[model samples]
Target: MSLKYAVLAALHEQPATGYDLTRNFRTRMANVWNASHQQIYRELAKMTEEGLLEVEEVPQESRPDRKLYRLSDAGTASLATWLAEPQGRPPTRDPLLVKLFGGDLVDPASLREEIERHRRNWQEELGRYQDIEAEYFSKPEQVPFRFRLQHLALRKGILAMEANLAWADEVAGVLKDELTSRP
Candidate 1:
């Protein structure tokens, strides 16, 4: 539900530096959750202070010291507690949906273009999910047990994106017909 839970879940996978977590957000959490580098680094510090994360500093020869983090027992407990609480899927508040609802006020053609743009973005996201699934999940035997757990979440994203793109197409068609039929 909270960013803290996501962070804990990630750290539970393996010990990682703040940079590593950020990279994971870009690739692994791209569909699920995305946090900026700054946000992640800040959360790491906060979690460390809260005793939910264990940090180990490793000296580097050329660069500054790196701090690797792992979930503490408290963090693990926290995550489990949160998980047991049956929270449904996250809600999305897209401004485009609002605009679409009142699209008659604007130029129909422009509104249709906006819907098309949103559809294109979702199409791109679906492609990314498909690519990741193919690259990492196709060979399930090679992946770790934890990765097998992730397959469902990844599949959920792929399905949601697909259904959304289909909905977008349907709405766009309606827009075209409605506009064209206007007296």
Candidate 2:
């Protein structure tokens, strides 16, 4: 999905400044979609020009004025249409899988190190997912539908990480066996 749609979806819940949107993306949307602050700011500008989003300047005494963005009627309609469309297959681009496919030509020590690193990353990701889950459980009633979508994404991420960690451990075991049996 395009950043425009993501931005529109975020604004659908409530109006927010660009900075607020950025924080929302990082904390709540990071599992499903990622966007840099610059990208979000640029998309907000484009959406404003396209009449999909409306921006209001909120004056501040001690800081720069904030431009709060809200979804226009066009933006809401666009988001509804996009959400109604069927999702296509996601493109796969796993760098670790590419490296593993070329394992026969790789140095055994280096491959083992890479696998260990992947295991660590998965562990960290699992922790993040667990945190999200915990937060959801803490306030079931307050959880929004969009946040529910994010929770599902986090569940998928958690499972993916578990599978990766299992695969890495198995590969490491095989590599160890090969090294020990080398004649």
Candidate 3:
């Protein structure tokens, strides 16, 4: 629901430094929620002050000390409570979709170009999700029961990317045959 909850979910997995959380966000969590490094670090500070996280500073010889954050029991309770509550679909705000709503007035060629770009992006995203799935979820038998939910979330991402690519293909085909062929 909030950045605070995302941070709590990350730390719920394991204790990690802010940098570690940022890396996780880039690699896997980005599928669910995207946050810049600065946003993450700032949220971590706020969470720390809110008593949702406990930080342990580990000093390094040549490098700066790293603050490893762990979820407090209160945070754990909060996370569990939040998970139990239902989440509503977020209000849509996709500019491309909004523009596509006016298909009769819009130029077909331009719309096709935009769809092509979106298809390319979805393809790239699918590749990344597939790589993660193969690397981690391939051998579900080997995974502990605790990680099943994580795999489930990853599956959702892969499916979403696949669906988006499929829709893009259909839209492009329609534009080429019907829309673009007209005056």
Candidate 4:
């Protein structure tokens, strides 16, 4: 999906300044989509020009005025239409997987180290996901019905991290055995 749709969905939650949207992308929406602040600000401007977003300037006493963006009527309809359309899984394009496919050329030990690094990253992310689950979804049933889907999205991330960790461990084990058997 395009980043435009992600931006629309974020604004649909609530109006926000470009900075706030960037922060949300780094935190709340990190698992779903990744975009730089520049990309986000640029998209905001384009959407505003396209009549998909409405920008309201809020005055501030000390700092410069802030531009808050909200989804326009057209944006709402656009988002709804996109949501109703069926989605297919996008193809995965992970560099690590590609590297693993030709692991025989590289030193097995070095490849294992790279896999370990990825494993550590996945572990760290999994911990963060668990923290979010505990803080927001401790009592799932008590959560508002509207947010259940958000929780489900988090679940998807959690499961994905778990799967990656499992796969990495298995690959690392195979590489370790190969290294041990060599000498």
- CA deviation > 4 Å runs, candidate 1: 88-92, 141-145
Residue 103 deviation, candidate 3, in Å? Answer: 3.0
Winning candidate number (lDDT): 4
What RMSD does model 1 have?
A: 1.8
lDDT (10s digit) by residue, model 4, range 92-165: 99899899889899889999999999999999999988888888789888888757777888899999999999
- Weakest 10 consecutive residues of candidate 4 by summed lDDT: 142-151
What is the alpha-carbon lDDT for the whole of candidate 2?
A: 0.85
Global lDDT of each candidate: 0.88, 0.85, 0.88, 0.92
Query: For residues 60-176, could you state the per-residue lDDT of candidate 3 as single tens digits?
Result: 999999899999988898889998999998898999888789975878888999999999999999999889888888997789876787888888999999999899988889888
Better of 1 and 3 by TM-score: 3
CA lDDT, candidate 1, residue 117: 87
lDDT computed for candidate 3: 0.88
How many clashes does each candidate structure show, in the order listed?
0, 0, 0, 0
In order, what is each prediction's RMSD in angstroms? 1.8, 2.0, 1.4, 1.2
- What is the descending TM-score order? 4, 3, 1, 2
Off by over 4 Å in 3: none
RMSD of model 2, in Å? 2.0
Error of 1 at 73 (Å): 1.7
When 1 and 4 are scored with lDDT, the better candidate is: 4
* Model 2 per-residue lDDT at 142: 74
Candidate 1: tens digits of C-alpha lDDT, residues 28-74: 77877879999999999899999999989999999999999999999
Q: In model 3, what is the error at residue 181, expressed in angstroms?
A: 3.0
